[model samples]
Target: DMEIKNTNTIQYRSMVDKLIFLTNIRLDIAFVVPYVSKFMQTPQQTHLWAMKGILQYI
Candidate 1:
């Protein structure tokens, strides 16, 4: 699988950081949040999609 770097790096990182904070109260997302956070430095479109899905889940 090819991973394309996200152009909206700042936005992605910001959202992921928010998710990281959410993980404390939202136990269900604890696992997934860290998984997505791994890509924060170089998030791809897929990563952003995952973040959106997480937001929808919340």
Candidate 2:
């Protein structure tokens, strides 16, 4: 995993939510952000790792 830093759940959800709002207008992060947000419901360590992967992709 990339030790690229981290975020708390509250911050994570907030970020992804904002990204979701952008999805309606912006075409960039639309797809990846929602897919990442899905894990916000129950984010585990592994989920965070996956999210990080998505982040890298974005």
Candidate 3:
């Protein structure tokens, strides 16, 4: 993925948004989403990877 600015960017915004939505609907599966969501103000690549893994797990 291309390196970009901060959470204001589209990619990060979309990823975090999806994670939040999915987490709300499937809390039992991706319980970690809430914790990860805390970083939405300034998420990093690690958070994105974790969200991706959570997506795969779900």
Best by lDDT: 1
RMSD in Å for model 2: 5.6
Clashing pairs in 2: none
lDDT (Cα) of model 2: 0.66
Q: Higher TM-score: candidate 1 or 3?
A: 1
For model 1, residues 1-58, the per-residue Cα lDDT tens digits are 3333445677798998898899889998988877887887877777788889989999
Off by over 4 Å in 2: 1-7, 44-58
1-58, model 2: which lDDT tens digit per residue?
2333334565567767767786787787776876787877656677666656655665
TM-score rank, highest first? 1, 3, 2
For model 3, what is the alpha-carbon lDDT of residue 19?
A: 74
- Tell me the TM-score of model 3: 0.61
Better of 2 and 3 by TM-score: 3
Lowest summed-lDDT stretch of 10 residues in model 1?
A: 1-10
Question: How many residue pairs clash per model?
Answer: 0, 0, 0
* Whole-model lDDT per candidate: 0.81, 0.66, 0.68
Candidate 3 per-residue lDDT over residues 2-53, each given as its tens digit: 4475433556568767877776677685667568668767777776777678
lDDT of 3: 0.68
